[model samples]
Target: MSARKVGMMTEDELIHVIRAAVREEFSAAGMRVDAPADVDEARRDFMFLRRLRGWVDGTASKIGGAIILAVVSGIVWLIVVGAQAFFNKP
Candidate 1:
């Protein structure tokens, strides 16, 4: 789905879409997806693998953000060091 379409959906609709997509993905992977009737029910369960895909997806975004920040910071540092060297030269 497009980001614009998802952005226009209500909270409940978005939840349903996301849940269905996750179920489809799990089914494709040959994993048994036993989704609860509602998200609250899923949260109540104590299964280790439940919501693992969501956890991994969130973690991957966080890692990507961190890498982007690090790369930008390095570029900024190089620019600053080069500026200082140019200013200090005879």
Candidate 2:
């Protein structure tokens, strides 16, 4: 294996070398990689995911609330029925 000298490269030169090496490796392996160039596109993606999560959470909370309300209403109805049956008998 060949040896490389340490700290011999400037920052820009080092960056260029690293980018070239990555490009060559990817090209040799026949892979395609793309990076987003626009900040707006990334922001829109983040917002969409946030809205989707909020929608899911809101729907779940509504369903849970409705279930609890139904159970409480059913229990109240049964209690009313029992009270009427006991009090109206005499």
Where is model 1 poorest over a 10-residue stretch in terms of lDDT?
Answer: 37-46
Per-model lDDT: 0.77, 0.81
Give the C-alpha lDDT of model 2: 0.81
lDDT of 1 by residue, 1-90 (tens): 556532477989989988889988866866545744444444555354557767999999999999999999999999999999999999
- Which residue pairs of candidate 1 clash? none
RMSD of each: 12.4, 6.8
Q: Which stretches of candidate 2 lie over 4 Å from their true place?
A: 1-39
Clashes of 1: 0
Q: Against the hidden reference, what TM-scores do the models get?
A: 0.46, 0.57
Residue-level lDDT tens digits of model 2 in 1-90: 359767778999999888878866765766433345434555676799999999999999999999999999999999999999999996
Q: Candidate 1's error at 49, in angstroms?
A: 5.3
